[model samples]
Target: MLSRTYSRRVDRVQAAVDALELPPAVYRTCPFEPRELVETGLRQWLRCCGAAMLDRQVIGMPSFAVDEAWHGLILCTERYAAFCRRAYGRFLHHHPQGGELAGSARRAGSMAEQLRRTAVAWSFVARPGEECVLWDLDVRVGVPEPWGAGTRP
Candidate 1:
């Protein structure tokens, strides 16, 4: 899942910022099928979120993940879904699974947490080098038959 936010500087004589909450992770609703997790899909998802932050494309309706961190998603004036595809694709190339998130979690020589729930969102803060701090958004999966928690993260 991812959280997309934008602060626009509006000024006639001053500046202001606007923040919008995005949807849960793109793959949150997709079932993991209890296979100890897969590599390709999750890694691709993370890469997309990171790219969205770097690209500055995320907007309203950021997605989320199990841990409640916000993954950055880009917003395109053209359409939101289109943006998702672009971001996801970029992630696939940057951090291929079975090589990173999926493969490394089981080993000690690696980094990157293995995520359980997919609901997610994101945001970014400036830092040195080409890397911005990566975030995984938080999303809620409604209770199976009826009620669930209404707490805010």
Candidate 2:
């Protein structure tokens, strides 16, 4: 069973999805089982939410991390949302565990002070699914190296 916080987050994400005004058919074909779909969606949703809180801009054109990092220093909610939707459509492609994704977001949020001082920001990109990457102002530092390779998620 999902925790209360997780469940609430899921509800919010679902609400956001509904607000997108997309047809039901878009969500109906999720490749995962119903339960798994919800789990994956929750993670992707949180990732999107996290990215939305950062300073970045959404781009209509998709590009590699290197290019994206150089394009802007601000985060983009539109890009994040579209990425989440695409990840859901792809059945969570390279989905990480829901707990890990959520926890990472929480950790990132808690590091506001560090981020401001280090000239760093975190964001999520679809890459066809959710992937967490760190940016040093305008340079792609790299993905949160396995969550503990000399850095916290």
Candidate 3:
């Protein structure tokens, strides 16, 4: 069973991340349409990432829009760092595959494997009856090369 304190903490962190105002330029870089949907998905993804940090899990990003939003957040170094401390008691680092840290334990696997892990992570953090739209967010938003069609992450 989960304690109220834990639940409240999750809620508080989710609310804080959702309230974050990402740079306007981020929407331009995202390869998705309907800014509203992208923003909504991005916030949910960010909240999940924050919650996943509690268990030190390496949750892969499945949506380009969400990834773009994350990039924007990281650009605001001060705010992103402080948000991490408040939400997860530490800084959430981004270790993209093929980067200098490619061999690091934090580096994610192939897209298929990464998406699988993302789905599993979502299972742990999602609220009851909450449907995850991240897997097919690209398709739903009409991205040219959608990553997955009916997948859930």
Number of the top candidate by lDDT?
3
List candidate 3 stretches off by more than 4 Å. 3-8, 100-102, 105-113, 150-153
User: What TM-score, computed on C-alpha atoms, does each candidate reach?
Assistant: 0.21, 0.21, 0.79
Tens digits of per-residue lDDT, candidate 2, 40-60, equal 333333345433333231211
- lDDT per residue (tens digit) for residues 1-153 in model 3: 668876777777776776676777666567567777788777777777765665556676777666776787687789888878776677888876665364664455466666677776666568788777787788888877665565553
Better of 2 and 3 by lDDT: 3
lDDT score of model 2? Answer: 0.33
Candidate 3 minimal-lDDT segment of 10 residues: 100-109
Please report the candidate that would top TM-score against the real structure.
3
Order of quality (TM-score)? 3, 2, 1
* Per-candidate total of colliding backbone pairs: 49, 5, 0
lDDT of 1 by residue, 53-122 (tens): 4443332212222112222222222333443344332221223234446544344232222221112222
- lDDT accuracy of residue 30 in candidate 2: 28
